[model samples]
Target: MTDMRAAFYDSYGDVDVLQVGELPDPRVGPGEALVEVRAAAVNPVDWKVMAGGLDPLMEVRFPAIPGWDVAGVVRAVGPDIPEVEVGDHVLAYGRKDWVQAGTFAELVSVPVRAIAHKPAELSWEEATALPLAGQTAARTLRDRLAVTDGDVVLVHNASGGVGRMGVQLARILGARTVIGTASERHHDRLRELGATPVVYGEGLADRVREIAPGGVDVVADFVGGVYDVSQAVLTEGGRYASIAEHDVPGIEDRIVWVRPDGAQLQWLADLVADDRLEVDVVRVFEELEDAGAALRANREGHGGKVVLRVSED
Candidate 1:
């Protein structure tokens, strides 16, 4: 039997429940590809699943592997998949189901529709950070909110992985001004990304008003408490999208979930190849064994993406 290393949890609990061990290699199915995972990104979902926070919402099978974003080379292609072949570099958002084997393994099998060709300009680690956050950002701005040129866009938590992607994508979508809320320290970085940085705190609304005096055309709130503030700043018919749960007056019913789309992923990959998009990975752990620690750090709000470097060769 082929052996592969993976970080798995047998029982839903804390980070301590995560175990790094050898497991039988995953087998690819028709229309799937076996990826020699070079890197896997840790999202909030990983920790939430491991700690049982999502148990009430979704049933997780035991011995679940936790991760969503991955970048790797195709090691073997299963029958009936023609989009990729062995040795093709790729980036993918693994299925949302936590019960299945995940990217935090030396190898992972993913459906063909979840992947995109890795941009030639990015390294494996950089590509690893793109799928989850990038796709979410794209879907939120382009599809959900339908932002347009001259629109004013505001993104909460502007320096984080998803927030940064939102900032950049908003600019690309031709928003007249992209205003971001972050700590005082990240203000400069946000500005460099073509966003007007405002410190998010007690008076977030006032600060945003000062920056975009007319009002916001779109608000993408990645931070939870900014929902009401986002709603307040919108021009009539302005759109508001949030990745986190928030209770915003007048717009509580507008919340939507982001679904994975491979065509969107391909468009994002093209942006990366053309240097219009940037992947920000804050740090990379060398192996799946370190996933527990990485998850812990991620929970503590480390900036950018934390990726696990998984390899068998």
Candidate 2:
């Protein structure tokens, strides 16, 4: 009987519901790769799923292993899958339509579409941090809003994992200027990333207007509830997109759902190799059972990515 240690929750509740124990080894279905997880990042969605917030939206079977991001080595490939072979280093946004089990385990089986060669320049934790947040940022700016050169872009919560990625992607896309909203503490870091930093809160619209006096060309809202500021600051014919707000009251805005796309992950990895992008793995919990603590850190809004080092490798 093959078994591996994993963090799982049999019932929906708080972080207390999470438990670490042995589970039968997973099978790799055709077109799937069994990855030996080296590191996995804890995002807000992981705890939310464990707490049943997404129960009505996505199916969750009992004893669900909770996580969506992983950086690891391919241990085996199912028959007919030629995209990746054993021993390949890879990373994935391992999202499934339904939750059965996930990446918070030593070994996770993911479809080929979700697998990308790990960025040559990134460490395991950094690679794990890239998928979910990086994809959200890239998909919104490149596909939904289509930001281009000479365009002024405004990003809400620019210091966060997702917002910071948006700031860098905007620069890579040739935006004339990137304006970011953050607390006073993160303002300097935002400036270092080539963004004009504005303290987030009252007078946000006015502050953004002052930076891009002619009005901004695009607005990417990572923090929700910024509809008013988005409307007030966008130029006529400007585009608006949000990862947190699904529906806006007055305007047509796109709500981004980060999806798993190996090709898109490769694009992000390339940027990392070129040193044009960065993933800050701020905290790492070494034990698998410490996943609960990792979730708590995410809940507390710890700055940058929080990762679980699944193995020393």
Candidate 3:
């Protein structure tokens, strides 16, 4: 096995637990492809998993690598991996059932079912940014909320990565008018994305009601603490879903932990290739070693995705 540098955490804690050093290369399992990672996007789950916040829900092995979103070239294929060949550019929501090795590394072993061809029109960073957030957004809108044609959809926390895509995807999926919540600073940008922008916080429901009048037909909550707002503004029998796991009184909304699907990714990639979809890569860390910083930035909640460029050096 070759030696490769990776960002891993030996124990659960703060960013200080992260280590950037050499480790034995991962073994590609049957039905998997070994990818040479060019970029990996960091999500809130990376930091949460690293700090043991999800200990009750997941198993974490020591010296665990700390990312899941990867955009790379297939370096090799394990036995029985007929889906991808060496040298194919791909992206994956390379989440294993358990936490052990991950994508914040020079290479990753991705299941064939989790890999999709990267859209040629997108940069590596942009492609990396899409897997986790984009999938979550797409699934939340399509499956969980059951959004459909002419539905008045409201996207909460709509300035963040998933929320931004949720707004766009809702439109593409035939939402009549998309309402989104963000800070005053992001209102114009939301408007440009074809969403009716409203400031989040107090009286949010009122603002949404003014725009939709008859209440929203669907609510995609990327942020917690908005169940009350959604309830107030959603029409009777309206659907609701949240990417976050927050406790909200009286509303039984779907709490989505999105699963990896290469087919879904391929469809989304087609949209990106057609220029109807865009990924906002707000920040890119040039070194994989700074994965800790990237995780911290995810918690800070920027306008778009945070990514790490895995340096070949």
Please report the candidate that would top TM-score against the real structure.
2
Whole-model lDDT, model 3: 0.89
Regions of candidate 1 where Cα sits further than 4 Å from its true position:
96-98, 246-253
The alpha-carbon lDDT assigned to residue 224 of candidate 3 equals: 87
TM-score of each predicted structure versus truth: 0.95, 0.97, 0.96
lDDT of each: 0.84, 0.90, 0.89
lDDT at 275, model 1:
86
User: 115-153 in candidate 3: lDDT tens per residue?
Assistant: 999878988988899999899998999877778899999
Candidate 1 colliding pairs, count: 0
Candidate 2: minimum summed lDDT over ten consecutive residues — where? 246-255
Q: State the weakest 10-residue window (summed lDDT) of model 3.
A: 244-253
Please give the distance, in angstroms, between residue 139's alpha carbon in candidate 1 and its true position after superposition: 0.9
Q: Candidate 1 overall Cα lDDT vs. reference?
A: 0.84
**Cand. 2 Cα-lDDT:** 0.90
- Residue 80 deviation, candidate 2, in Å? 1.2
lDDT of 3 at 264: 91
